[model samples]
Target: MAKGSRADHSARLAAFSAGIRATRGGKSLDINATKLLVAITQADDADRLADELVAKGFRLTRLKTHGGFLRRENAAALIATTEDRLPAALAIIRQTCRARTVTWVPPFPDGIGGIGPAPMEIEVGGAVVFTIPIEGVELLGGDVAESLARTRAAGGAQ
Candidate 1:
């Protein structure tokens, strides 16, 4: 390949990689052996928890969700990491998302008559985590590929 052709190839590869990363919430393809889908019910704690997780070297893809029972705002954080790092991710979530008591009024019943909505206290603000196994990961180019290369060079698990 010519010198200019090589540069063009690099630029094209970078753009392709960036497109992939953008679809995944700008998170790099860390190529981990395990994937964790952590559903955090308390929307209020999402920002802080996400920042802390990133600081600890974990990449996350956040999804805005709603709770079925409470019908309240919730967030689901998708984290990909090696099996060895699973405990660390879980620990961060546990430490960041603390359970707390919340008071709310229950919705009125459909058939019952002369009954008013009553306040109820319940516990909330905790994370529900699910672990999944990832078979493989492929990075196109750019910083994500470089990072993956560095991880492999350091003898980290693929």
Candidate 2:
């Protein structure tokens, strides 16, 4: 092939590949718009959900959290993706983070003759998702030395 035609062929091939990938429902191609999906789920579900999201080409950060309702440890999945991929990400969350009922005992005050309230069946083990349209995002990296020092200090405190 002639030099000019070879360049043209390469450009066309790139475009064609991109089109095919887009049609195949790969990760969102739209990079201009960003969405943040904050999913607070049961700790057990969070690990699996985060893994699945990553496997599906969604970027996410997993965090250990505490929930107000139970004051129990939970997992928070912070997903940053584009609108095109939002629905698929949500479907994965819905399928993985299923809600179930658990028995919870209510804590009574000290005046209650030292007996606690009856255990009640409460809905739990589900996920709460908040979708936020992100205007912009900035990542501030931390210094390695500083992080190491902080970690050492935390360990000393512990």
Going through the candidates in the order shown, the clash numbers are 0, 0
Tens digit of per-residue lDDT, candidate 1, span 1-158:
36456444443334222112221334455332455556564898899889988898777789899866789998889886666778888888898889899998899888889968879998888888888765545544555555443444555443
What 10-residue stretch in candidate 2 is worst by lDDT? 16-25
**Candidate 1 regions with alpha-carbon error over 4 angstroms:** 1-30, 110-113, 138-158
Instruction: Please identify model 2 stretches exceeding 4 Å from their true place.
Output: 1-33, 142-158
Name the lDDT value of residue 77 in candidate 2. 90
Error of 2 at 137 (Å): 1.8
- My TM-score estimates for the predictions, one after another, are 0.65, 0.66
**Candidate 2 lDDT tens digits, 1-158:** 46456444443223222111111122222123367899999887987898888788676789999867888789989886667878999999999999888889887887668567899999888788999987643323433223323433444211
List the global CA lDDT of all models: 0.66, 0.66
> What residue pairs clash in candidate 2, if any at all?
none
